[model samples]
Structure formats: structure tokens, C-alpha cells
Target: MSNSDDSRARDRLAVMAGIDVDNPELRRRLDAISARTAERLHQPVSLVSMVLDTAQFFPGSHGLDGWLAELHGTPGEWSFCATAVRTGRAYVVPDATIDPDQATNPLVTVDGVRSYAGVPVIVDGHVMGAHCVLGFDQHTFTPADLAELQDGAAEIGELLQSYRRGDTPA
Candidate 1:
């Protein structure tokens, strides 16, 4: 997309609006979304990550090691969610080693991450984060897989709105 669009998207997340990452209720809802996403996509890792200017917070996640406890989030430079959020579309990287944009992404550590597919989680008409799945093999997702993820993202959007409205994410 255009730089203007990127800027507009960047301006919209409203992180200052305050997302309570530690909210147990929010975590429960996000966990369900992440688990379902992983199962539906047949990937080893699934994450509902908020792509802030500073980092990608894995509020809802699967497949993360203990490193996340030590570090609240992954650096933006190493965040695939950052690129996906900027694109405003589903970012499909079947093979990180071959994808120019993702080849250097830290998620592609040696035998760790080889595939990724993510849908932008647009909140209040702006990009806030991504609902994504990752794997250790070069697995190309089908169109149905994308549809499933997009549908899941819609649920996350609803949850975000509910959180903003001070309602239960359910």
C-alpha cells in the first residue's frame, strides 16, 4: 500500500486507549481464538498479537517458549505482525527462507519458523494487530485456510470492541 495509508493505519491503533494485556477476561477470549486458529490452520503456533510501535505483544498465544515471560513482547523489527498490520491484508509466507521480506525475520530461526499466514485485525477501521499462525515447515495454506483466519479475525475485532466498551469479550 501507499505511505499515506500506512500512516493512517499507524495513527489509528490508539494504543493509548489502553488495552489491558493482563486482563484475565480478555486473555480467556483471546486464548479461545488463538487455539481455534491453530487448530483450523493446522499450524503449530497461533497468536493474537498487538503490533504497537514498540513491540508485538502476544496477548493470546500458542507455541511460545518461556522467553515471552522474560520479554513482554517481540521487538517490532522482528515482528511479522508489523508487516501484516501495515499491509491491511492477509500476509502469507509459505517459506520464510525464500520470501525476501521475511527471510530475515527472527521467527525464521533455523528450524523454528518456516511458514506464516496472518490476517490484519482491524479495529475501529484501523489496523491494530494480527491473528496469525506459524509453522516449522513450508506449508502453503489453501484459500479455505485464509477464509477461516479472516473469520477468526472478525471475532477478535468484536472482542476488541467489547473490551473498549468495557464489556466482556464473550
Candidate 2:
């Protein structure tokens, strides 16, 4: 499918799955997950973000401050997590400042996001969003780190699926 078509389908499934971006309870749970992931990975920031058509929404986040934290999201063009969703795999940038694809990204230039790693959060065979970690300094992620990140993403997927089934409180 085309990128736009895939985005639309993912958005539809997110809605059908009852993923509420603004639900405080859900955000709390997601933030807990993000915090754990950040601590485990020794990263400064972590987020469970849903990549929508117009933006990437951070339903769960840790170690954020200022406007980005307040907004809980960024424009689609500013998302590193979107690459993971689109690829249905992990996307890693060891140093955004040196990566041609990421050099000019606002998150890199303005937000000082020098390193990033994200794994796709899949639910029912569809790519939903991502579980990602960020670092202000350049850092390379190992295979083990990717595996751990993927485990976190899987947990997020299960959490969302449970909500969709009404097996958990919203």
C-alpha cells in the first residue's frame, strides 16, 4: 500500500482499538512503561508514541520538559518514531547531527535529539506506532538494546489490545 493509505488504515485501526491519546489513565500506564524502558536502557528520554496522519502523539513519556512535554506531541515531520511505524521494524539514528536524513529534522536541530532508537508497536498484524528511546548525546544502540526496546513495544501492543477488548480500564 501507499504511505498515505497505510497511514489512513493505521489511523482507522487506532480508533477502532480505542486508543485514546488524551486518556489520563492510559497515559499514566504508558508513562510507567516509558520510565521503565528509559531506566533499563539508560536513556534520558523514552516515549510510547502513536503516529497519526498529522502528528505523533505521546500518550506515555518520560524525561521531557518545556513546550514539547506540554503539547504531548509533534508534527509528523518531526517524528523519528514514524520511521519505525512505516518500516514495521526498528529505526535507529546513532547521531542525527551526522545523518543526512535526520540532520535538518527539528527534533535534532532544535530539540537536541542526537540519538534515537524506535521499535514498531504492532497490534493484530498492523503497525500502530512505536516505543522509542532518545538521547541528547550521540549513542549507538546494540542488538540487545533493540531486543529490549522491542519487548517494550510488544507490551504496549498488548496493553492497547486489552483496552480494545475492554479487558482493562480506560
Candidate 3:
């Protein structure tokens, strides 16, 4: 995509408005979305992570040992999550080992991630973070895969909106 379009796409996420991550119901909804995403993608590791100044925090995830705690303090270099936020587009990494853009990411080298696909979770034009799925084996993705991931991320945003309006996520 063009840099201009990428910038506009990223500007579309307004996660800083209307909701706070500290809300319990919001966390619950994010977790549910993460779980469902993992299952739907048939991926062993899936995560809903939000980027902070120095780290990315996983409110929800599937697979990986001690995932919640372990993934909580991931630095920027370890963050494909942050990349999604920066680019404002879904990242479909068919092979992490060969992708120069992410070849040196700590998660790619140390975390055993071969294939990574994720969509940024944006709310009210602010980026919350990303909903990501990691495949242990190298793989290819289709348009359907991107659509599904995008839909799941949108659901996360919608859930946050619902919480703000005192309604349940649909």
C-alpha cells in the first residue's frame, strides 16, 4: 500500500477514546474474541495485545506456556503487535524466518513463530494493539484469512464501544 493510504488507514483507529482497558467487561470481551480467533484460524497461539509506551500487554491469548504473564512485558523489538499498530494494516507473515522486515524480532527468533498474521485492533480511530495468530509451521494465507482476522479485530473494537454504551457485545 502507498504510504499515504497507510497513514490514513492507521488514523482510522481511535482507541484512545470512549473506553479504558481497565474495565473488566472490556477485558472479558477481548478475551473471548482472542479465543474465538485462535480456534477459527486453527492456530496454536493467538493473542489480543495492546501496546503501551515500552511494552505490549496481552489481555487474552491461547497456547504458549504462561502466555498471559510472559507476553505482558514484551519490548518494542519483540512486538509484531506494535508493527500492526504503526502500519494500521493487517500483517500476514507467511515465513518469519525469511521476512527481513521482522527477521530480527525477538518473538520471531526466540518464540518459535514461523507464520504470523494479525490485524490491528482500532477503536474510534485509535490503535489499541493487535489480534494475532501464530503458526508453528510455515504457511500461506488467503484473502479469507485476512478478512477473518480483520473482522475479529473489528469485533474487539465494537465490544469496547458496547461497554462504553452500557450494552453487551454482540
Candidate 4:
């Protein structure tokens, strides 16, 4: 499905979850939560991203520089996070070197990102984007890790509701 279609599904899910996407405080909370999740997961990079009709926006990220660059890079096809949202499921690559999908993806190779784990950031029930973690070494993700990632995604949804309630854009 297209990005907008996916986002619309997420928005509907958010509404069902009683999350208000107009709150401004949600942005701060999302940022803080992203940091905490990253630290807890012991991952080098963690992000709470929103998939727009075109680009992905990282209102919250840890262990990364340049919001517009790292979090919000090219469109969905080039973004693993976007793929998660589009698929409405978790996507993990223990080693990009061995992932066929990464063959044409420059970021995975150029940045030496050997592993990546992403859970759909579901606002309500539809996935708006994802909460993702990246590692530089070959890493293995477990059921516990996936659980934690899903929890983080839920938190992100709540934060988005808060942001919407506050009429804030992120």
C-alpha cells in the first residue's frame, strides 16, 4: 500500500485507542522515551518515527546526529522503518550483509549497520511508522527484544495522541 494509505490506517487505529494526536507534550515525551528505550535496549540507534505521505519524520531519536538526515532520509523504499510501517509488522535483519534486501540499500552497507530491528509504531492499531533499533555488529534479536520494541511502539502511539491533543505537529 501507499504511504498515505498506511498512515490513514494508523490514524484510524489511534482514534480507536483513544489517543489524541493533537497534543504537543507528546513530542517531548516521545523524545524522552526514545532515549530511554535505546538505553534499555542497549542499542546504538533508536528512533520514534512518523511516516508521512512522503517522508519519515523523527521527532525523537537517540545515538544519531542530524534529525533531517539520519531519521528522515529518502522515501519508504530506501527506509527500513518505512518498510515496517508499510508492512504493519516488525522487520529485523540480524546482519545487513546477509540480507538480500540490503544489497541495493546504500545506508546499510555504507554506514556499517550490520543489524536492525524495527516494530511498527502503531497509533491506535494501524501503524504510523516504527520504533527501531540499529546495531553496528552482527546482532540477534529475541522474543523479549521484540516485546520491548512493541511496547515502545505503543508508547509512541500514546505520545502521538498527546501531541495531537496539544495541536502540535511532529
Q: Which candidate's lDDT is highest?
A: 2
Cα lDDT over the full model 2: 0.86
Model 2 per-residue lDDT at 90: 96
What TM-score, computed on C-alpha atoms, does each candidate reach? Answer: 0.86, 0.89, 0.79, 0.78
Per-candidate local distance difference test: 0.80, 0.86, 0.75, 0.73
Task: Give the distance in Å from residue 20's predicted Cα in candidate 3 to where it truly belongs.
Answer: 3.1
Error of 2 at 25 (Å): 2.4
User: How many clashing pairs per prediction, in order?
Assistant: 0, 0, 8, 16
> Tens digits of per-residue lDDT for model 4 on 63-156?
7765344544456566778778778889998988889987557667576678889998765456777898888888999989889999988877
User: What TM-score does structure 1 among the candidates reach?
Assistant: 0.86
Query: lDDT order of candidates, best first?
Result: 2, 1, 3, 4
- Give the 10-residue window scoring lowest on summed lDDT in candidate 2: 161-170
**Superior by lDDT: candidate 2 or candidate 4:** 2
The local distance difference test score of model 4 is 0.73
Winner by TM-score: 2
Taking every candidate in turn, the Cα RMSD to the unseen true structure, in Å, is 2.7, 2.5, 4.3, 4.5
List model 1 lDDT by residue over 1-170, tens digit each. Answer: 59996677556756425455678888878888888889878898898888877678877877666576456478888888887787788999898988998887766864368988999887777778899988889998999999998998898877877776454654
Off by over 4 Å in 2: 1-17, 165-170
